[model samples]
Target chain A: MKKNFKLYISLFLTTLKISAFTFGGGFVIVSLMRKEFVQKRKWLTEQEMLNYTALAQSSPGAVAINTSILVGHHIGGFLGSIVTVLAAALPPLVIISIISLFYNLIRENLIVSYILMGMQAGVAAVLCDVIMGLSASVWRESKTFALAVMILTFLSLALLSINIIFVIVACAVAGVIYFGKIGKKGLKNDLS
Target chain B: MIYLELFWAFFQIGLFSIGGGYAALPLIQQQIVNNYGWLTVSEFADLIIIAESTPGPIALNAATFVGTRVAGFAGAVIATIGFIAPSAVIIALLLFLYNRYKNLKYVNDALRGLRPAVVGFIAAAALTILKLTFFSESAATVGLVNIASLIIFTLALIALRKFKIKPIMVLIGSGILGLVIYGGLSLI
Candidate 1:
């Protein structure tokens, strides 16, 4: 347990540092996470990492936290998860806490504003690239249907202010229906 | 008990937040601004700005920012812990059961359908961000400079995709571009 605790602490710190420095949100963090968990430590297999990502994306909170907790738990169990969560949360919590104290002082600065605007542009670009890249992956698996849904959904939300939760819930329901239909087809095929 | 409630509230947010942190923004806004009345919309907006500018996940950053706002340092800790608790629990449970269900065919088919929806959700999020950033009808007229900014953003994006450059570097380059434009405008 003691040795496991130390490993958890190390993993937590690794995650914290990665989370702290990697900007442009969750996608950048995914690469950093792969480096740490997959390339360096080999704590998780590629399939496990992909599975964790899927679970993390669906489950909520921050993908960062969910990924950390999931990865940590996989490597070291319950205590590992606890330590990883702390590690993942602490750096940002501490940094943001300090920023909250001095946010007003920084708010009106021209240079800071310029930097943020730049970062925002960069963030927007990165997000677009991610969407495009991920779209190809989606297309590969299911061809035109997934691509069409993706583009359509993007247009709907981009043009109109439709609530996102409605989109996700609809998709999840669609998944259930597709599977149910497939199952019925399979059973009939088996009998026939 | 207050802390527990705070934890639980954030936990629920964490649990239901698909498409990562940004998707949770509306939910957080609803909970903090509408339901709890913990912070004003403007305050929440300010926190979001800071959260975005800072180097962390927006959700955790918001949790910390709003937590501190609500209950100081302890509140920040409570909120952070609350936000992460559910995912940790759920992940562990999933890991334990993953092998048992790994080869199930219906499960695979369901995942296939769900993958497209996830794509839809992400695309939806990207659209929301674009709308938020670009199309503010309340601003009356779009300025020439803003249009220039958009063009520059597009070029920067093309460069990014072509070169596979990191976003931070592009951000710094854009920051320099902004300085040159705005500072030149002031001189003119």
Candidate 2:
């Protein structure tokens, strides 16, 4: 009982700390979470972190909290997942609530506006970095095919201004058609 | 009635907000600003800044902010739950089905295509924010590009990419740079 409680506390606290301190976005918190769980505690392997991060990204909802739930489950079962999620979510809930209360006082301040403006620009660059990393991974698999899809997707969203929902659905359908033929069995053969 | 609309709107956004927080921006902009008129376009842009700088997911922060605006505390609670429900359900399903179904070609293929498309969305989101940050509404008529914002952008990009700084550090550094540039200039 004591050991189980200890595990739960650590899981909760660690998630809380990462969620509270880390800023920018889900992807940024991800690296910190991996360092703590996979590197420091050895609760999960490197491959598992990579797998869950990818899962979190591709799955719906908040990637940071989703990942905490994933790793928490991997560690402490369903109960662990619940604990970790609450821990991950609580800090933000509280922080934003405070900000909401002070919204008017802060919103019109010239200094606050300037800082926010600066942060937005910085965030744009961060998002661009993520794009480069994501594209590189996609390109490494099937260069020409992935490149074509990425270019098409970017242009549609950026220039044509297509609805995001349609863009995602069309890409998913294309994935099913194109990749349905090339299963791992065939992929294995190709590698050899 | 507004609460019900808030619930449904956020629930849909949460369900569809794939590719992480940035992709959620366009959806939130559409629903909250364009669809319901809860916040003006400029207000939505400021909300994005708040959402990004604050902890947690952008969607969660958004749900809370919009909910509070529409219906106070209860609205915040309902909207947050609505936003989280699909994600919780989906993640739980993925967790359970993950090992058994991971290698299926359709699964792999769907992800393969979805992956790049998601990146494209993130890129689009960045461009959108870039426009929001740098271009003023008056720019259409006056063409007043904020030079201070341009300087901050270049400095921030250099700090992030060249020096390999952490994001929080970059944020703080930008704040200081903002105070120095914009604060000083406004006084002039």
Candidate 3:
């Protein structure tokens, strides 16, 4: 019992540190987690971490949160998952809460708006990098089908201005049908 | 009633944000900005800046920020919970099934399909932010272009793609540049 309690506390603290410090996005957090859990603590094997990451990415919600929950579950079961999630979530909650409280004051300031305008451009560039990286990876894996889907989805959303929820659902159904047909054959081809 | 609305809106965001944090941007924009008018387009961009520079998940940060903006501390608590509720339930069930089955062929296949589409979703989001950044107002007209913003965007992109500077650093650099350039202009 004492050992279990210690594990949970360490899990909470490690995740809290990771959540509080890592910047960028979900993938950054995942890599940091790999360093901590697989390399530092030896709590998880490489294969286990990889599997959990893939599952976390595919399942839904914030990948960082999902990955943390899975890691916690592996180490400490349900209670562990809860602890890690709280640890992961608490920083953003507190930080953003403080920011939002001062949001009006910040928004009304001319200098701040100028800074935000500059930051906005930076944000767009970062997002563009993300889009390019994601699309390139998709294009590499599936080629035409993936490219076509990406372009079509972009056009529909950007030009046609369709409701985003509809686009997601349509893609999901399309994915099931398309991938289901390819099935084992596709997997085999990818291995080669 | 407002609390319930916040929960439902964010619950749907949690449930549908399939790819990751970036994937959730469009959904949050649709619900919070477009549907509810909780935030304007420019404010949404600021939220993105804030979410990225700060730690933790972008979706989680956005939920907390938007919630706080709409309803204060309690709303922040509620929205944050609502955003994670689906993730909590879904992940638990997935973990259980994953342990039992040991294979996830169908899930992998669906992800294969969803992955490209998620790229599309994110691209659309980038376009929206880019449009707002570059053009003064309407995208079609391309009315007064913000040359300073364009310069910052180009430099930031080059810095990211070529120099491999961290995004947080790039954001900070851009903000300082903004102060020097824009603040200097205002002085004149």
Candidate 4:
């Protein structure tokens, strides 16, 4: 019981600490999470951690949320997933709640609005960087066919205004077919 | 009534938004802005800024903010839970079976196909935000260039790429720049 209690506390506190500065974004938290779980606690091997990162990226919801759940389950069990989920979800809930309390006060302020507007522009550029990085990595990893999939996805979303869910599903289906048949050179580059 | 809707809406967001947080932005924009009318176009953009700057996942922050705006404390609670439900549930299920099927070659190929598309989706979302920020609402609209915002955007991008600044720092810097340029000058 005492060991279980200790494990739970570690799960909760570690996730809380890791998520505390998720300020940069969800993906950024991976490094901090690595430090805590892999380096410090020694819970996960490097390969395990990499697998978790890949799975977290592919899974639904936020990367942080999926990661914490995976790590929690890795350490504990079903109950561990719950604890990790709560741990991952708690800090943001608290912070946003505090901000929400002041939402009216800040929303009414002209300066905050201006700052947010400016930040929106900044956000756009940052997003552009994210896109460039994503495309470059994708190109390096898989080459032309992957680039074709990306372009088609972009065209439908940007020009056709198709629903994003539909776009994603269609792409997944395409992935299954294209890679299933074109298994010549591409098979060596598969992530699994 | 709104609570039920909030739960359903965010649940869909949590379920369908594959890839990760940034990829999720487009779906959240569609639901919150176009479908529900929870926030205006500009307000939704600000939501991204606030969500990006705050600690935690952007999706969690967004659900909490929009929930609180629409329904208050209860709203926040349900929305956040709704947002996290799928990841926990589906991932739990996957964890159970992952050991067996993790090595399947077909699975690898399918995921390979999905990667570029995920990148594409993220790029599209970024472009959508860029259009909203740079131009007016649509292409036909004239001269709503938001020049001051453009300046911050350019500077922040430079600070990020050239200076190797942290994103939080960029956001804080943009906020200050916003205040100095817009507030001190009384532009608005």
lDDT digits (tens) for residues B31-79 of candidate 1: 6766688877545645555665678888788888888877888988888
User: What ranking emerges by DockQ with the best candidate at the front?
Assistant: 3, 4, 2, 1
Minimum summed lDDT over a 10-residue window in model 1 chain A is located at A114-123
Which prediction has the highest TM-score against the true structure?
3
Between candidates 1 and 2, the TM-score winner: 2
List model 4 lDDT by residue over B21-100, tens digit each.
68788788888988999988777777878787788888899999899889987899999999988877877666666776
Model 4 spans > 4 angstroms off: A184-192, B136-143
Model 4 chain A: lowest-lDDT 10 consecutive positions: A183-192
Better of 2 and 4 by lDDT: 4
RMSD for each of the candidates: 4.5, 3.4, 2.9, 3.6
The window of 10 residues in a row where model 2 chain B has the poorest summed lDDT is B136-145
Ranking 1 against 3 by DockQ, winner: 3
Query: Local error of candidate 3 at B171, Å?
Result: 0.9
Q: Write candidate 4's Cα lDDT for A1-192 as tens digits.
A: 899999998888888877876676677888888988899999989899888887776667888889888988888877787888888888888888888789779888887876776677788877877787788988987798878988998898878888887877777777778777777656666854
Q: What lDDT would candidate 2 get against the real structure?
A: 0.79
Give the i-RMS of model 4 in Å.
1.8
Higher-scoring candidate on TM-score, 2 or 4: 4
Give the Å error, residue A102, model 3.
0.7
lDDT of 4 at B2: 94
Which CAPRI category fits model 4? medium
Q: lDDT, candidate 4, residue B60?
A: 92
User: How well does chain B match by TM-score in each candidate?
Assistant: 0.66, 0.85, 0.94, 0.86
The order of the candidates by TM-score, greatest first, is: 3, 4, 2, 1
TM-score of chain A, cand. 3: 0.91
